[model samples]
Target: MAGLAGAPADGVAQYRRVVVWRHGQTSWNAAGRFQGQTDIELDEVGRAQAEASARLLAALSPGRVVASDLTRARDTGEALGRLAGLPVTVDLRLRETYAGRWQGLTFAQIDEQFPEEAAGWATGDVTVVPGGGECRLDVAARVCAAVEEHLRGLPENGLLVLATHGGAARVAIASLLGLPHDRWAVMSGLANCNWSMLEEMGPEKATRGLRWRLAAHNAGSLPEPVTVQEG
Candidate 1:
């Protein structure tokens, strides 16, 4: 079960955990091309990465698994679902940023072609939309919403494994923190096949929503709680 603390349907404070798992490496990712809604399947390395990572995540005993509609993300989630014995829920809203013109272009190509716009886009500027793709703000808005929607449906003491893209993972974390556009730039990008954990810190006595904390970032293993002994 996750540490997500909030008033659930039973009118009691329940806790749950969310893991934002980035899809494994893809050929486009290796080539530094912007995938953005592209249906690129995972490369051979990606399949191996997914299997290894999902095996580790199964240790957390996630209650449910959800993934983006894209093949890369779907396959990654399916890996975890198979290991955890959980059904996967697909939601298009969790899709990667719609990087219109930049979909297949490399960062260098984007910079060389649209120098001015590329800088702002790279820095997470809300107004900059590389190749008319979805801006950082738009990506955050939908990704966070989709994740929270699933979070709201889980048992108080459950874990949600979200298989998504790097950009969506970064935006979801920043947006949940209520950071402005400028601050969003400071959130580092998620590496392929890595995952971050957000824990709910709100009190059971409170009547408000859960307060999330960055428990772990870019983690390859599930952190188990342990207590020190008096030697």
Candidate 2:
């Protein structure tokens, strides 16, 4: 809604809107296991959540639906693609952070076995490589690259949907908005099947060195107009 107001006649043509939707819940998710790049399928609740969320997302009339090649993300994207009649595009770069030795471990297990690493991660240290896996910056770079590639041919005013993982989505949004690494942790992790919205701002309106602005974060509902009184 913030991006929809005060636009020139061709304003809509100047930028594109992106919806970064986190894949629905998986069995690992329910059990608090780290699923980095595990290629897990959606559990029953995950599938149902995807179906429900897809119906809502379809109303936004997305022009493109792209997702991580991992089964959970791919399946989630496919749900929307089916409703929107768009084929889902798979991109491996959109996959979750390769969490190396931490994969398949529960949170408590990590805390017990890798106390230092777990502690750093708990503090939102973007530099922590997660059991020697990809750092947040690494994840951000690849995710942003994938999003940029998909956005290249997007039409003006069109929407692009990304069905991705929670960790990947968090870093992507922070990096795209040009937030400092320390501030990246300010954004909370997304819930299963929830999404964040971003809109590109024309040069005239963009913040210094930033191209995209967050329209919504960790959201399940569609965009709505906001009314505020100025002092």
Maximum-lDDT candidate: 2
Identify the candidate with maximal TM-score: 2
lDDT of 1 by residue, 129-170 (tens): 768877877888898888888987778778899999998899
The segments of candidate 2 whose C-alpha lies over 4 angstroms from its true place after superposition are 1-14, 227-231
Q: What lDDT score is found at residue 155 in candidate 2?
A: 91
Candidate 2 structure quality by residue, lDDT tens digits, 1-231: 222333335423557899999999999999999999988999999999999999988988889999999999999999999999999999999999999999999999999999999999988898998988989999999999999899988997778999999999999999998888999989989999999999888776664666788988888765455565699
Model 1 regions lying over 4 Å from their true place: 1-14, 204-210, 223-231
TM-score against native, each model = 0.88, 0.92
Q: Extract clashing residue pairs from model 1.
A: 2-16, 2-17, 3-16, 4-15, 4-16
RMSD of each: 4.8, 2.7
